[model samples]
Target: MLVPNDHVDQTGSQASAVRDADAVVRRCRERCDQTVAANEVTEAHWVARITAIAKDEDKSAFAEVFRHFAPRVKAFLIKSGADESLAEECMQDVMATLWQKAHMYDAARASVATWIFTIARNRKIDLIRKNARPEPEDLPWGPEEQPDQADVLALQQDSARLTDAIRQLPEKQRRLIERAYFGDLTHSEIAAETGLPLGTIKSRIRLALERLRHSMS
Candidate 1:
């Protein structure tokens, strides 16, 4: 797409004027041949590919970046205390920002992964502050009306009911429930966050479900 005349940077080389980047990666890899395994592609290659996407809005390039980088972004968010849903949502937001800000990326200052990860980190912190409730800022999740309270579609109807049941669990159980299902933190990390012995955390989660089931009954 042509940028508006005012928006176009006529002074800069045409964005498409980027050099044939394929040879660049292959050439770099050949020198590091022994250090890099047969299956392993270096980050340099990924950066070249992503830079093309960033410049051109190339769907394939963006897809490649999403495939490799999305999970890493999500993992970073989860470690910083985002629940699973928030982590997943924020991962997408970060990737979207990357797409919009790709032109701003300069490999001279940072690696591609570092640039993307920094974007995710900043977004995660912004999300946390936005999600904070008030002075106490305690709540960590969003809310919804009951399944019966909506003009529910067939596909979402069952899920809504199931989630409502989960949402109604005790506060401690709800966090456990979220950690187990939503998957922001792994089992060990959850244990660390709650200051529970790993085994006890596991046990409580197991028991928490039994209670949830009975409550549904």
Candidate 2:
């Protein structure tokens, strides 16, 4: 028995749809494979650079790492609440540590970026804590007095305004700000947690910070 013309057309359309979907799947798989291979090559290249510095005291390799990572490390420090000057100083220290302790790197344990950023983070914290310590000249010579009530009231008002400003932020910006500040997560960590691109996470956080500063000001 012959099938109806409309039924034959419908069956052919279904087969075409299947073929199109299969092609799409193949393309996606190929792209994913390419991306994975590219990432592996990049990781190996960085590992080799660090190894060269460790084994041969390679200035060129160190330069390559510094040139690439200095800006990223500084940006990370700034995002973690350091001022520009402090970030610059900490970034320099981080690069110096990388050079002096290249032998300490373990490719099996962490990626080059992770190692470098970890150093930067620690250095930033150290510098901040050091600066926070009161100098001998800054110490009070007498018994401490109570804080002025007017000053306390002003501080509370400022805090309340800041809280209100944060609440007024767009949901996306507020969430990012909370994650970056209150949640104490780095941009890279936030990107990993949210499945966002690193650049995107940075952009959102930067925009959110600008908004907060403007609101506070």
Candidate 3:
């Protein structure tokens, strides 16, 4: 039976449309798969870097983490209302904790960023409490908890990493981190002194930390 010409033309157009749609679907699937694979590779790279530091006492590996995390940790402290100098002190303590406690890190449980940030958050609170204490003359003399040998060693290791990492930051971010660490002014006080909005200060600090994490990693 001879098909009508219009019928044949319509059938061909429908088939062509179907093929075009299929092609688009295949390309999208391929792109999605590639993206997933790339993400997995990046995750593994960070996990391996941190694991090396834990198992080998690898300064290079620790440097990688420090370069990425220390500045950001300082930024977080500043955001949480620490003075720059106190924040810096707390940031250093937090990094030392990371080095010493690297062995405790489990990629299965948390990402490196999460672990470091938690330490920073806790240390910031501790510093506030410590500073709130009355002067020596106001309080009775009593024994304080002595730092352990391992902590001392970990802090010693952090000196080099901290120095190098700070240099690698952008000038503004570096200064922000330093001020957050060393400036006597509290975050609110600093805002008042500098005449900058509190939200702007926090946002800049947050962005700096995120950039540091991405680039250093």
lDDT of each: 0.51, 0.55, 0.52
Q: Per-residue lDDT of 152-217 in model 2, one digit per residue for the tens?
A: 222222233334456667888777865564327765776534332334324433454444345446
Top candidate when judged by lDDT against the true structure: 2
- In candidate 1, the residue pairs with backbone N, CA or C atoms under 3 Å apart (3 or more residues apart, or in different chains) clash, namely none
- What is candidate 3's local distance difference test score? 0.52
For model 2, the run of ten residues with the poorest summed lDDT: 138-147
Give the residue spans of candidate 1 off by over 4 A: 1-33, 36-41, 130-217
Q: Quote model 1's TM-score.
A: 0.44
Model 1 steric clash total: 0
Enumerate clash totals for all models, in the order shown: 0, 0, 8
lDDT of 3 by residue, 1-217 (tens): 1122232223443344334433443444443344433333343345556656766788887787778788988887777777899878888888899888776654433446656766775676566677542322211111332222222222222222334445666787666654654444476755433223334324433454444345445
lDDT of 1: 0.51
Evaluate model 2: give its TM-score.
0.49
Error of 3 at 181 (Å): 18
